[model samples]
Target: MTGITISKGATVIMHFSIKLKDGTVADSTKVNNKPAQFQVGDGNLTESFENCLLGLSKGDERTFELGPDEAFGQANPDNIHHLDRTKFTAETPAEEGSIVVFTQPNGAEIPGIVREVVGDSVTVDFNHPLAGQTVTFEVEILNVEGNE
Candidate 1:
């Protein structure tokens, strides 16, 4: 570990910023003064995202562009569902553009965005909000701990 570098099983501490094609920042670790720390090859990050960190060392900065498929992935039509409005009460109205969390049979909580609301029906999209969009990812490696 003379010169630390990011690789499989390595622990990494870094700051990252994700932005859309229109330059709207989707997320950033620097904003809260808290850097992200994770192990390479872990399920915490997408494979493509981890690939971008490979070969990076402390103090190194990089920027890369990822297509929709490589980032959040293309939106699946099956992820869109229409539900009866009766499911939502006055306190939890299914208003357009709002997000709601639904529980799955396996006890997983899935968040869905309300796309449209019509008479007694609501269209909700379970796909990630960043799905189907190109994105720019920037990162600054702060620390790298090899698995040696």
Candidate 2:
């Protein structure tokens, strides 16, 4: 295992920070001094994102930036949906930033975060909150191996 030796099914622990296009911190495991662990190619991280760590081993740290297309891609206008406030109940508070779960016709439940509330209409955006934004990833490779 010479350079960047990680492989499929490898378990890795990493400290990471994700910054938005505005340079606002979106998420960081390092803030709390805790690291995240996950198996490679398990669909938790995107292929492009995981590819960045392919051969990195323990104690390897790097800061990389990926463009909007490679990151979350441009935001989609179709993801915006308007729903009546009557759809919400006391048990489920309807407010901006509240995640509301709506079931599809096929019985699969999907969640949308409330973006705005006006009169009787509540605007919910189904797109990833980070969608369309260029992002910077600061990562520290804690461990790497080919063993699943």
Error of 1 at 7 (Å): 0.5
Candidate 2 local Cα displacement, residue 54, angstroms:
1.2
Off by over 4 Å in 2: 1-4, 103-109
Worst 10 residues of 1 by lDDT: 85-94
> In candidate 1, what are the lDDT values of residues 1-148, reduced to their tens digit?
2369999999999999999999999999999989999999888989999998899999999999999988999999999999999888776679999989888999999999999998998999999999999999999999999999
lDDT of 2 by residue, 92-140 (tens): 6679999888899999988888999999999988887788888999999
How does candidate 2 score on lDDT? 0.86
Highest TM-score model number: 1
* Candidate with maximal lDDT: 1
Scored by CA lDDT, what does every candidate get? 0.94, 0.86
TM agreement with the true structure for every prediction: 0.95, 0.83
Question: What CA RMSD would candidate 2 show?
Answer: 2.5
Off by over 4 Å in 1: none
